[model samples]
Target: MASEEIQIKTDYITLGQFLKLTNVVESGGMVKLFLSEYPVFVNDSQDQRRGKKLYPGDSISIPEVGTYTVTRENA
Candidate 1:
């Protein structure tokens, strides 16, 4: 079966910023809380850090929400 892909463009974003950009969390504190309770998958692996830095070409998956492909936009 074919997989669905969602692309996001940004320069350099931390895990917290990514969550905000994706409308996953409203604030940093909320991001932290969600990270601690929910399983965030990075490149198909479980990532449990809210401070993890994310760059271009990084893929993140959240259960039920699907996957997102990160792409850096030129400055």
Candidate 2:
């Protein structure tokens, strides 16, 4: 699977926001429905919470989608 990097200026971001940022879903409202249909993995562990806090080093994997790595860049 291809790996993608998502840069964030803040300390953390929510899974729902991340999904939208990555274009995995069209909007935040679709996050919940999307999660229920697909398995989302945080560092290889399944996570279904749209509010889950994702740190800079956190890695997200969606089998139907692709792998994403959270990265923090100084602004």
Candidate 3:
């Protein structure tokens, strides 16, 4: 089945920080474990780096959590 995409504002967010903001995992260690064990697709490609810098226009897709397109919005 296809997953729905969720848009998230990332005006000044790094990949690690974004994961924390979205509550994907409890901490950086958890995110690292999840990224290694689980499939995290970025723009349809697998992304295993937990500290991969994410900026506006980047998109990430998680199996159970659906997709997230990065957008820059005013804080």
Q: Quantify all predictions' global Cα lDDT against the true fold.
A: 0.76, 0.95, 0.71
Listed per candidate, the RMSD to the true structure in angstroms reads 2.8, 0.8, 2.9
Query: Between which residue pairs do clashes occur in model 1?
Result: none
Error of 3 at 29 (Å): 1.9
Error of 2 at 39 (Å): 0.1
TM-score of 3: 0.74
Number of the predicted model whose lDDT against the real structure is largest? 2
lDDT of 2 by residue, 1-75 (tens): 878999999999999999999999998889999999999999999999999999999999999689999999878
Error of 1 at 46 (Å): 0.7
Model 1 global lDDT (CA atoms, 0 to 1): 0.76
Ranking of candidates on lDDT, top first: 2, 1, 3
Q: What is the TM-score of each candidate against the true structure?
A: 0.79, 0.95, 0.74
- Model 3, C-alpha of 61: deviation from truth (Å): 0.2
- lDDT tens digits by residue: candidate 3, 10-43: 4446666767777888887788777777888777
Best by TM-score: 2
Where does the lowest 10-residue lDDT sum fall in candidate 3?
Answer: 3-12
The ten-residue window of minimal lDDT in model 1 covers 1-10
